[model samples]
Target: MNKNPVDAALILVFLYPLLKGFLFKFSSKNMKSDIEEIGGYISFIIGVILGTYLTKKIFMIHQDGVYAKIYNNIPEQIISALESKPLLIYVLVMPIIIFLIYKVVQIIIDLINSITLYPLLDSIEDLLKGKSGFVKRIIGLLFQLPKGVCYVILLALVLNVLVIIGVNDTYNKKLNESKLYGNICKNIINPITNSKLAKKIPNVINDSFKIVIKNSEDQPGNESGKTIVYYNGITLSEGIKSNEEIDSFSRELVKNKKTSKEKAKIIYNWIGQNIEYDYDKVDKILDNDFTIKSGAINTFNTKKGICFDYSCLYSAMCKANNIKVRIVTGEGFNGSNWVSHAWNEVYISEENKWINVDTTFYKGGNYFDSSIFKLDHKDRKIAG
Candidate 1:
């Protein structure tokens, strides 16, 4: 009557080593060999995980300078070709680093096991020479438990990833029916991932990669043949990436705010007061000198950016507070003349409607959820 074939399969996988030990008659030599094999596999898994962690840390801390110096000399054409797929950099570089670290750790563990570990086990076995059969079997099972647990953890991780990626609805449903998998994810993986520390972990991976989907219909302000690239499920001007500083700062800014409207208003005030309009960069951009970098990270760090930067930073902060916001590109009347500009449209859950916000013009007037916002701002394209 139990509806858990997946759990049954997992249980068998977990007991595979114990069954192996039984088949080998629980000899000290066989037990020692199995433990050594498990140790090696465990070491490899640790290496892979550590390698991935360290690689992400290294990139987060030193990606800008290191990446520039290393990739600076590449041909512009090649760089341009790869620009459309920035995710490729992580895909190609991360694996090599992980493999090297994994190999090094595996070799060290192998050497240690060969030279000292096996001999130590043999010595222990000699001392327990006259142990009762029951005791020996219990010890053997105890030794095999690590391998069994490791297999279960690894399988749980794989299944969790499959569910995240949404490979197949039926497959995911079946995997979810496994109580063992659910418990491991809920009790172990989820706690670790949802912890405050994990929440604050830099969006380095997200920053490095943007999932792009082309918009077919023609929209104003968005140039023809341009693909819509998204970062963290929000539409953004190209090159706007988030980081740990921005993530933590955004959360801190909204920690005390009660409502989404209140959070959005306070964020608006902070940006207006803190982020200075970079007139020089704006002039350069207007002159077609597109060398300056501007985005959420840039604005958060330098406190200087134009309309696009303002809107991107605003969207990122609002998103951190669970507020639905999108970067809207259009023409805004700048007193003297209407010019190409970017702003935000925030969805207020209380009102069940989207409202306009232009943090760039925050200094001039109340641009946060104000009716006057529509008078100067003309609608164009919402970054999808």
Candidate 2:
């Protein structure tokens, strides 16, 4: 009188016909065609089976005992299991499930066509031709596929809703399960760190740093020039340190090299080598500012640009290095109050100064003179 074996076997067989027929009927009505009806039915059955299996597997891994331990106890166990499995398993399984579901639907369509629809079509036509008694029977049978599919779908939906409502406790347990949570995290984190996407990080970081420095150099004039140009908008602080990009760059510089001064020197040289001053380009100003990353990338790719290009390149490079950097804009020499200019100020820890490093003039190897650093180059604005 063992009930377990009998119950399990009966459940499996009963489910096969009940699910298959229900899905077939539901699909027929909704799809209004035999092919779609068969496909829908098979798809529905496969989906339910796979979904049930997954839910069971998850439940087994987490839930313990009949009276189901408190919610906390179940999730704690499941989380512990996921950490031990390799990431590939998760990646491989998802596609397989999708394929299986598709195959199941295909098989079901073939079975329905061969066993039911072909034999029934002749009778259906005879009834339509006015063969009284046979006509009623054929006509009724003709609507069977569509009606069946609808019934199946409705039943399946109702059952699913019931399970969701009834198994609230189990669902809650699964949600809080550590293994489930861990799996979610692993799925998100592993791809980012180990995939091709991670390779782009270094380039992004490097470019950001280069642009910041380049933008700083594009600012016009020496300290005394009548056009006291600002980089982006802010007047260059006497040693240049004010924003996040420069500060972060300063830290990275110290970490990567012997001193902040050495890092600053490399950044300074990069700007000087990359940016060039263009007077004709300045006259046709359109936009007041440009982004460093896009500017540097474009300039490097095209080999031609204006001060805005330099400013954008320098700002982006500094950003890549996690430095606090900004593009400043203000008045320049010759009473041209609207003459656009760009520059940067980087923080140097050893000197405890935000030094102004003009890559444009610095590239020209002009001697550094404090006399050229004029205070009249007022800060008009700032952008990062």
Candidate 2 whole-model C-alpha lDDT, 0 to 1? 0.41
Which runs of model 1 end up more than 4 angstroms from their true locations?
Answer: 58-83, 86-91, 176-179, 186-384
TM-score of 1: 0.47
- Among all windows of ten consecutive residues in candidate 1, which has the lowest summed lDDT? 201-210
TM-score of each: 0.47, 0.28
Error of 2 at 117 (Å): 99
Q: Who wins the lDDT comparison?
A: 1
What digit string (tens of lDDT, one per residue) describes model 1 on residues 1-384? 666877876788799877665444446578667766776667656654665455444332223566545456557775565445434434554567767776787788778787887787788788778878776766677677788887876676566545543456467557645667666755555433223323331111101122336673585787787767543234464535677778788899889878888888888889988887776765565455555776788788899777777888888888777899888876664422234577888988888988888888775545776533554566468863
In candidate 2, which residue ranges exceed 4 Å CA deviation?
1-256, 278-294, 334-338, 363-371
